[model samples]
Target: MLAKRALSIVGGLAVIGWPFAVWLVISYAELHILLPILALCFVLRLCTLRGKTGALSRAFKGLAIAGAVLSVASIWMREAQLLLWYPVVVNGVMLALFGSSLFSSMSIVERLARLHEGNLPPAGVRYTRRVTQVWCVFFIINGSVSLFTCLAGNVHWWTLWNGMISYLLMGLLFACEWLIRIRVKRRYE
Candidate 1:
């Protein structure tokens, strides 16, 4: 158990650090080398997942599998361009997961909100659904930008956007939603 936990932590860090690693090492290393290392990270993540069949868990598993496949394809085709597409894939998968949840009985945000407040009022449900919709829009915009960066063929720009700017944009969205959530909570109360 301890070993698994340690591996999980390492895998998590490697997955999160991928963009920085690419930025720092791509000059020194070959794309094939980096791609296999990424594949290893995905396999470790897949092995470490909790034994849940919820939509969130399934989404995680799907992401790991997709990441591994992308890495393998990059290696097989001997094309570094495929490596840059990882961020786009990440956004596409996220959009699918969150977008599909909108049609389900509960939006993903509603399910998460319920974890904090056991029974959400009607207004809260509407708020959560709206938040989910916003997330879908964010994913679409982010993914399109990521695709643009990947195709632009400027490695530095790709690294900056994928490694730094995209994260900042996500944080901005999260912060805005949090502030909005406070207002929402007050209104419902």
Candidate 2:
């Protein structure tokens, strides 16, 4: 179980990190190398998801795969506009999953924990829901703004500002989730 959880975390990081790494590397080299690497990572990640049989997981998987495909397609399309749409597509799907789970009768966090392990405390569930809600809101707002900026074709200094702000917000949300999870674990212990 511990190994599975660790693998999931590592896999999630790779799914998120590989594209950014490719982008960073391409910053110093040719753009052509970026697409193939990004596509490979995306495809590899999509191939590795397991126990994602639930509706929410399936939806997330679909959206994530679609977003990755669209991102690569955008490169070929030569449309920076599609880059903005990428976040919107991925984040929108995540928001929908969170929103639906928030209203469900089942404990979403518990379900997620069970997916990783066997059982989790009620406090853990509450903390998970709260943190996931915040993450959903973060993605929705930033994603919408990014999509709008892309549509407007505004490549200004504020664009960098937007990217930085979004990154900071996500980082803070991730930290808060970790903190809440730790607090819940300590309380139970």
Candidate 3:
């Protein structure tokens, strides 16, 4: 159990720190070494997903598989350039997951809101759905920028966007959402 928890923590960090890892490793080490380490991260992520079954779980598993596939491709081709696309792929997968949730009866945000509120009123449901839509839009735009970074092939620029600027934008969005949610919640109360 202890080992599992540790692995889970490491896997989560790997996923979140992927671009940074790429930047750091490729700076001092070889792509060959990073590829295997990245593959291990994906495998660890997959192992952590064991026993989870749902759309969200499947989405996460798919992400790990995609990362592993990229790792394999980079290794096979001996092309470190392929490693640059990892962030783009990540954004695409997230876009798909969150975008697909919009078509379901409950939007992803609605489901999350339900977890805490238990019985979200109709207004809350609508709000969550709108929030989910906003997230979908965010993914589309963010993914586009990531693709641009991949295409540009400038490691410094790519790392700056994917590792720092992207995260900052996401944090800003999250903060705005929280503030909006507070205002919206007060309306329901």
Candidate 4:
């Protein structure tokens, strides 16, 4: 359990740090060694995957790894104009999958709740579903806006703003999930 939690923390850090790392590498023209470091981090992350969470985490990590490689290569080859948009595309794809899974999982949860006559209150279930749906929408909107900002060649501050907004929404989503879980537990007790 400790190992799983640690892996989760590390994975979260990797995801959040990746963009800033890329920006640093580009700004400092340190492509040679930083690229290899990024690749090594990706490999380490790949070695940590063990189950369903691992599988999904690995998928995103792989996308990030590939994007890092492509970004470095593009810069090295003087093709920044083309490869600059790679991260945007990768992030968009990841968000789409993440959003879809939230919707699907919520549907399954609701279906299972329906199996019992005196199951969870309808309002509670609806609240859970609605919260998840809002989260899905948040992911989609954050991803879309980030991609647009990246593609538009805006200043670095734009990306920072996108990151801040995404992280804020994610924090709220986590809080909502925790509250829902507490409610569910209370219902059973």
* Candidate 2: C-alpha lDDT: 0.62
lDDT of 3 by residue, 76-161 (tens): 88776777788787778888888888888999889888989899989999999999999889989988998998888778888999
Misplaced by over 4 Å in model 4 are: 1-11, 50-91, 98-125, 176-189
Stretch of 10 with least lDDT, candidate 3: 23-32
* Candidate 1 lDDT over residue span 118-160, tens digit each: 9999999999999999999999998998899888977788888
lDDT of 2 by residue, 64-176 (tens): 57757765785777543444455557667777777778888644555777788676667666766776677677767877876676566554422453445666777887787
Candidates 2 and 3 compared: the better one by lDDT is 3
Runs of candidate 2 exceeding 4 Å displacement = 1-30, 50-52, 55-57, 113-128, 152-164, 180-189
Pick by TM-score: which candidate is best? 3
**lDDT tens digits, residues 1-189, model 4?**
787677666655765666666566556664545655655555455455644463355666666566556755764775444434544665566666555655564443354345553466666677556654665576577667777777677637544744466677778877977787778668766
What Cα-based lDDT does every candidate model obtain?
0.84, 0.62, 0.85, 0.59
Per-residue error at 103 for model 4, in Å?
7.1
- Candidate 2, residue 121: the lDDT equals 65
Total clashes, candidate 3?
0
Better of 2 and 4 by lDDT: 2
What TM-score should be assigned to candidate 2? 0.64
lDDT winner:
3
